[model samples]
Target: MKLIRGLQNLQRAGIDSASGCVLTIGNFDGVHRGHQALLTRAVELAERYGVPATVLSFEPTPREYFSGERAPARVSNLCTKLLDLGSFGIGQVVLHRFGSAFAQLEATVFVRDVLASQLGVRAIVIGDDFRFGARRAGDLEMLRREGARLGFEVDGIASVCAEGLRCSSTALRDALAVPDLTHCEALLGRPYRLVGRVRGGLRLGRTLGMPTANVNLRRQPALRLGVYAVEARALNSDGTGGEFLPGVANLGVRPTLGLTRCLLETHLIDHSEDLYGRLLEVRFRQFLRPEQRFDDLSALSAQMQRDKSDAAAFFASKSTGPA
Candidate 1:
């Protein structure tokens, strides 16, 4: 699948060349079940119309862009979302940069200039509640009217609901607070993942006889701080592929180390390698416990051993998929 970053990349690929593409536009943050439903419809439209299926999402999402500070914690970043989209068979993804200018465009102008003229969208797919453009005047009705005017089709799928609740990125965020992977998988159509580059650490884990690879995740608000049983993967140094390893991780300020910033430290079971500057993507399979200050190093070590045992057991009990 091709990744189109920003307008220049789109122009370079000749967006005007793809005259009959079916497009879906949204943040698509978690790519939750609702999103999956929407994308599935888009793919069907693409098949019916014999056009490329494309997703038009934004970087920094509209919420994050408008927020004076960083937006609330994200459920999934762009790379992970792209990977998930690939698995779902999306043909191409055009990442538009959402900002004041793009946000300020009137609904009609957005549909005419962006979706129709620029992207050549033969059809558009969105959730029933999706809104966009100039204080979000672009509703399903607006999209339908515009589709009629521009000779395009519109597909507005109802939000997917489960167990008397709506499936959404926001709802999934709340579920992740409980570190609930079962509910998360149900909503997300897969496990919740946190990904980032592995950076150098203070070696506190090594001092305690359990070394860890530090992963710097994208800053997210409402991130649960705790110890979790996880499945971890690192890109092979050769850049050829990834290696998955069962692991336990801690997400906190490391009160034991006198640290005050949230960080993820993971210990891969039965493997040791120097990974000072590599990307490590860890999927939280289950929440084992909350972060706590122990009385001393001995106590912490004992608890870590127990955590290791529990993580190993959890991995053993489940299929060794991408967590």
Candidate 2:
């Protein structure tokens, strides 16, 4: 899959208005089951029309741009979102910057200039409740009307449901806040995972005999602050192909260490090699405990040992299967 960073780059890449594509536009946060349904339909339409299956996503997202620090926790970052899109067989991604100027664009102007002219969107797929444009003035009806005028097709997929619950990013976040890994898996059609590049930390884990690969989370995450039994893997350069290693991870602002920023610190139980700078994916298997402040390093170390043991047991249970 190819990634076009901006609207301007589309022309440079020869995917201008003439080279029409079937597109799905959204934040696509988590790329959960509902998003997958839309993507599946988009790909089908693209194949029918013999055009590229394209995704038009935004940076910072519309909510993040408008809400700033008050924006809802993000289910996935840009990198993970792109990875999910590619995995779904999307042929191209046009990542547009969401700022004041773009946010102020009128509904008709967005359809004409951005979708029709800039993207050459031959077919568009969106959720039934999808809305866009200045103050979200556009809806399914508006999009269909625009598509009719512009000589393109528009389709809206109904909301997908898991166990009668609507499978949506908001629902996924609520499940994660409950720290319900099982429910999250149901909603996502897989495990809830975080992917990030390993970065250097203060070596506190190392000093305590539990060295960790720290992944910095740039945005607020949908996951609850807690320790979890996790499976982690170092991804290849293309963000695929890696054997998962069982581990225990802490996802939180380290209150004990007086840290203010959130981080995902995973310690592989039995395998330890340098992981700095490598893209790592950590899948949460079970919630262990909520993050808490510890009195000292010794107390924290003891709890860490128990967390490792619990994670090992969880993996063992999985391997042994139901009795």
Q: Which candidate number would show the highest TM-score if scored against the true structure? A: 2
Residue range with the least summed lDDT across 10 consecutive positions in model 2: 314-323
Q: Which pairs in model 2 have colliding backbones? A: none
Against the true structure, candidate 1 reaches a TM-score of 0.86
- lDDT by residue (98-205, candidate 1, tens digit) is 888887999999898888888889999988898988988889998999899889999889978866689988888898787777888888766777666678878878
Return the TM-score for each candidate structure.
0.86, 0.95
Give every collision pair in model 1: 73-221
How high is the CA lDDT of each candidate model? 0.81, 0.90
lDDT of 1: 0.81
Return the top candidate by lDDT.
2
Over 1-323, each residue of candidate 2 has an lDDT whose tens digit, in order, gives: 89998887898887988889999999999999999998999999999999999999988789889898888998877768888888888999999898899999999999999899998898999999999999899999999999999999999999999989999999988988987889999999989888889999999999999999999988758889999999888987676866788899999999998988999999999887899999998988889999999999899999999999998898898865211
How does candidate 2 fare on TM-score?
0.95
